[model samples]
Target chain A: MKKFIEKIIQGLFTVSGFVTSIAILLIVLFLFTEGMGLFKNKLVEDGYQLVVNKQNDVSSLSAEQIKDIFDGEITNWNEIGGRNQEIILFRLNDISNYFTDEELGSELEFVPEKISELIAQHPEMIGFIPQQYIDNAFKGKVLEAGKIGFSDIFLGKEWIPTATPVSFYGILPLVTGTLWVSLVAILLALPFGLAAAIYLAEMANHKMRNILKPLIELLSGIPSVVYGFFGLIVIVPLVQKLFHLPVGETGLTGSIVLAIMALPTIITVSEDAMRNCPRSMREASLALGGSKWQTIYKIVIPYSISGITSAVVLGIGRAVGETMAVLMVTGNSAVIATSILQPLRTIPATIAAELGEAPDGGVHYQALFLLGIILFVITQIINSSVEYVSAKNKI
Target chain B: MNITLKKRRSQHLAFGIVSLLTYSIVAILIIILAFIIIRGIGVINWEFLSTAPTDGMTGGGIFPAIVGTCYLILGSAAFAFPVGIMSGIYMNEYAPKGKLVRFIRMMTNNLSGIPSIVFGLFGMALFVNKLSFGDSILAGSLTLALLSLPLVIRTTEEALKAIPYSFREGSYALGATKLQTIRRVTLPMALPNITTGLILAVGRVSGETAPILFTCAAYFLPQLPSGVLDQCMALPYHLYVLATSGTNMELQRPIAYGTALVLIMIVLLVNITATVVRRYFANKVKMN
Candidate 1:
């Protein structure tokens, strides 16, 4: 009976472990299913295509160029590396401009055929209409609609996700903004965090260490939204006054908030590492006439460099993944950050701010998911590398 | 002798600077806590604690948000505790030390590192859209459960590791089976630590704004939630809306402070409870 019960318990354990592992798999699968589905979307709206005269040398057009042509920003074919001719834009609704309603008839039943004929007449003419309107047997050249490309998604500078004709899904600005805030945050946080960690681990008396330790843990436990509120009420105004800027909200404010938020992580991890340094090393350094500060700087730090490295890496991971505080304090300007004082939007902020309203399965929604994938991969890399360093150093 | 004097002066300076840095961290924490508490204490009252909002959330109290957060905590704990404890038990007791265990550990770490907002996205996709649960409490709880699972597993495993093998040996030598030994010996020894982990998980689930932002947070619902399916106001999300997009920002500023204060108190309470549990267990062990 005991053996049977043990078997049942073993089976339960295996099943639970298997189920726990499956959860992570499901999250990644769901993210990719929605994110990669963006690529399968047609550049043009469904049931519509762009057609030009067959003689036109341009066999394909980028979404941006098409938008430009339609918006009348680029009126000449020569501007797009094509023949030296003025481009004529046509929409199905613009048929009356070319042919009178009386001439084309009120029903406009043949408007599709006439639009195709109109396209054939002018080499520079680009017409957008129902895909069924274009007769394949006719001479109109149908522009091969391209799927959303890697360059368009990753390298594109504009993030206008609701642009007419096509939404721009470029993530350059958001990605750079995220990096800038996190970079500044880490830079500001590291020295102070290290100093505090060293003091707590090596210099502080038992009473001081006991008091300060729980305070730091409590700081870490404070909800990020509270930190964000603090940033709004305190840091934002402080930056504005200190820098004499027109607005308080900037990447600098976000960075400062993130720095504060990341401090507890860095200090805790690095201090633990410092404490873990064998007592004999510290005794020997002191016996050699090294001051406490000198001993910590030389012996304790060197002995646990990997642990400190992991601490900083984990701190960076926290800063990068942080959304709410950064979202609240950063001006939410979706522009590439020119300076720390300027307003910027991080990827996490963008997703948090925009995903609520974006229609499901829309380009905007999918782009947010893609941003999530990027964030997931970036943080996963940072964390696993930390894990690897710590694991490697374990022996 | 002059160089040695200069080195001594520099050492004193370094010591002063490091102490100053540590004090500054403490100062920052105090300033934040003091500011919130001073501004927020006045706003906490019976009416504020019991009543729902009125006049565009600028009047009345944050009762619904408080209840919603409690519901969310209860829901997530209900879902995560059993699964996480079970998985932790497996990893500690039954699982062999091998590549598979390593992979599971790596994945658990990875899960913890994934941004809470990304979890929001996943929750929105899987629970809200795919699972057709809509923006409901059940969906939010499931997402939060996933969020805290890694934390639970790691803590559970740590607690289990702290139990000596000799205890298990003694139980087995008494003719107890593996299951009985674990049930009768290991789990009791580990319960205090497991409770600490649960308290910590509560702190996490309550404080998290990003994951619940999409999954269940309502913009402004004054009444208490009637069912799991109904959207409900939560403390973090309520604070977010009041600060960012609510109709009258300045008017709601004090209320937002109160909400922040409440959130901080709850999280701090959970943290303190966990610490107390840990200390109690440590003392118990010492006494033994």
Candidate 2:
């Protein structure tokens, strides 16, 4: 009976171990399932479609070309495989420009009628009006928006998830924005973090080490939302005042916040690795008439290079995955940022900001899930590489 | 002679610069903490701690948020601690050292590195939709449990590994079985360290905002959760909402600061307790 009871307890422990493994698997599976749903069919906006007068030869355009046309970058119809004529941009708001209040009626109730008439008269015009406004008697042609392809999702530059006619799920802006912020953050953190690690590992006395160690741990333990708040209140305004920007919350603010957050990880890991360098090496350097700084820079640091690399990688992982702070300070603009001073939105910030309002299983919803898949992939690569390098160093 | 003198000067400069950088970390921590505490202490009062929020979350107190965060921490602990501890024990004491053990360790490390937001997305997919739990406390707790599980497992494993092997061997020498020796000897010795792990997990679960945002966080719910299936307002999520997307951003700024202060205090308290417990245990081991 005692043996049987022991066996039962052992079995329970085994089962518990597998439970965690299964949970990780399920998370990866669910992300792909929902995210891949967006590519199954042609992308269409819920209540609006791009329409052109039938006399125009252009009947279809990719989401990218449509965006370019709307931005007035494509001014000629020939640019989008149509007849050589000047492309006319017509929108719902443009109705008032073309007709008077009396022509559109006192209440503008006949606005759709006038819109249909305007579309019927112009062959070079493309209008983005509501589907409800396109009555049965309307004579214009609706453009066939193609299915969202992998290139558009992976390589396209725009990140407008609420675009008319078709929501652009291109993640280039968000991906670059995330990378740009993380890059700047790591660059800012590395010098300070390495210097601090070197001091604490080799130079600090016992009292100094104890005081600094707990404070660094305390820094790491502070919740990320508090960091976000600090950035919003302190760093954001400081950047704005110094740079004289219209808004204080730019990618620079995000980089500063993330650098502060990533500091403790880099310092703690590198310090431990440096401390683990055998005492004999340090003594030998000093015996050979080497200064403490020279010994640290030339011997201890080179010996622990792999550990320091892992520390840097882990720091990058933290900056890349951070959500609340970046969301709070990066201004959440879904534009391709050209400078650190410009406002930009990150992928995690996009998911956090937009997922609450996106309807379940919709295009917007699936696209956000795809963003998660991308994030998971990036972090997994970084994490696995860290594990591999550290494991090799240990061996 | 000039080159040697220049090298000596450079080394001294490097030492000065590095020490200054190290000291600045402490200064930065103090500055951040002082800024929040000075701004936030005035907002904390009996009314603030005991009353639910009103006036679009710009007034009143954070009573409901406190309750909700407590519920989340308790719920996640209840789900995570037993499984994580058992897994650690199996890895340290029972499981054969082989490829399987290595695989489990790799998985745990990978899970730890996954972003918290990914966990949020997974929770929404599995708990809120697939299982039809909807947005509720249960969904949020399970999500947080997954997030903290890797930390708990690693800490427990380290604690178990630190226990002296002679204790287990002595119990076996007295005609005890493997199970009895581990249960009667090994676990007790590692209990304090395990408790430290639990404290760290609590610190993590209470402060996380992203994982709960989709699974359970309610925008304006100001009442105590009646059941695990009910929606609740968490402090981190509430602070995020007030600071970033509030109806009146300027008016809500004070409440945001107050919430941040409360969050920092809670996390720091847990961290300090963990450190003290760890020090006490280390000293006890040395004395023995």
Candidate 3:
């Protein structure tokens, strides 16, 4: 009976271990399955179609070209393999711009007729109208808006995910914004973190180390939302005042906050690495007439280089994955940031801010999931590399 | 002599720089703590701590959010501790050292490193939508349980590993079963460290906002959650909403500070308790 009970307990333990492995699999499965639903969606808004005069030669437009045309970047039809004429943009709202309220009749009863008539009158015009408006008597040809392609997301430039006629799911701005903030954060954190690690590991007395180490751990334990609140109340105003900027919620503020957050991880990890250096090596350096700094810079640091590298990598991981603080401080703008002073949006921040409002199983919702996949992939690579480096260090 | 003098000067400079940088970090921490305490103390009266929020969260207290965070912490701990402790025991005591073990360890590490927001998305997908729990405390707790599971397992394994092998061997020599040996000897010795890990997990679960933002967190629920299926406000999420997307930013600013202070205090309190428990236990073990 005891043996049987032991077997049962062992089975429970084995099953529990498998639970973690299965969880990782499930996260990947759900993220990809939901995210890949984006491709099945059309580039044009649902329930809407692009219509042009039958005389026009332009038959269809790729998602990119349509976005470019609507954004006013591509004004000539010739640019997109169409007839050599200026492209005229039209939307449902543009009907009111061309016609008076009286002309459209009460309750806009003549909107469909007037829209078809307007499209027929101008060969260069492309109208984005409701599918219901394009009936059998419509004088224009319907243009097929192709489904969203992979390049429209990975390599595309714009990230306006809720634009009318078509929402841009281009990830360039978000990717670059995330990279910029993380890069600056690492740049700011590395010197300070390394210095602190060196001091605590080699220089500080036991008492000082005890107090300071726990203090730093306490720093890490503080919730990120608190850091964000601190940033919003204090750093934002300070940055604005110093730079004379219109708003303080720039990439720099986010970098500063992330740097602060990353400090404890970097310091703790690197300090442990440095402390692991053999005492005999330091003694030999000092016995050979080497200075304290020389012994550290030459022997201890080189010996623990892999550990320090893994520490920095972990710091980078933290900075990249942080959501709440970045969302709170970084002025959530979905533009490709050219400078640190400019406001930009990060992938995690964008997800956190937008996922609440995105309808379930919709294209916008799928796009956010795709962003999650990108983040998951990036962090997985970082984590696996950290694992590899530390594994190598152990060997 | 000249080279030696130059080396000494450079060493002094390097030491000065590192010491300055280290203290500056501590100083910054102090400034942050001080700033919050100074600004938030006025709003920390009995009314603020005990009453429900009023006037669209501009007046009254943050009692509901505090209670919600407490529920989440308890729920996550309940789900995570048994699985985590058992997994740690399995790895340390039962599982043979092999490639499979290495693979499981890698997966655990990767899971922990996955962004909290990704966990939020996963929680929304699995617990909220797929499982049809719909935004509720149960879903949020399960999500947080996943997030903290890796930490708990890692710490528990370390705690178990710290116990000397002789105790287990002695139990076995006395004709005890493997489970009995572990239950009576190793687990009791490891309990204090495991408790520390549990406290730290509570600290983490309390402060998490992204994972609960969609799974369970309500912008402002007038009443406390009476069931696991109900939505509730959490301190971190409440602070985020008030700071970023509140009805009145000006009125909510002070309250946001108060909320932040409360959050920091709870996390710090939990951390201090963990540290004290570990220290006291370490000394006790040494004395024995």
C-alpha lDDT values of all predictions = 0.89, 0.90, 0.92
* Per-residue error (Å), model 1, residue B226: 2.9
> Interface RMSDs of all predictions?
1.3, 1.0, 0.7
CAPRI class assigned to model 1: medium
lDDT (10s digit) by residue, model 3, range B1-288: 999999999999999999999989999999999999999998888888888889988998999999999999988989999999999888888888888778878888998999999999999999999999999999999999999999899888899989989989899999998999889889999999999999999999999999998899998887889999999889999999888886788999889889998998998899899999999998999899
- Per-residue lDDT of A54-159 in model 2, one digit per residue for the tens? 8988878887788788888899999878889898989888887899989988877888888888888999999988879888878788888788889989987878
Candidate 2 docking quality: incorrect, acceptable, medium or high: medium
Q: Is candidate 1 or candidate 3 better by TM-score?
A: 3
Query: Candidate 2 at residue A268, lDDT?
Result: 90
Q: Which ten residues in a row have the lowest lDDT in candidate 3 chain B?
A: B95-104
* Residue range A98-190, candidate 3, lDDT tens digits: 999999999888999999999999999988989998889899889978999999999988888788778989999999999999989999999
Clashing pairs in 3: none
In model 2, residue pairs whose N, Cα or C atoms come closer than 3 Å (at least 3 residues apart or on different chains), thus clashing, are: none
DockQ for candidate 1, please give it. 0.73
Candidate 1 ranges with C-alpha deviation above 4 Å: A1-6, A45-47, A53-57, A83-85, A88-125, A129-141
Query: How many Å off is the CA of B137 in candidate 3?
Result: 0.7
TM-score of each: 0.94, 0.92, 0.95
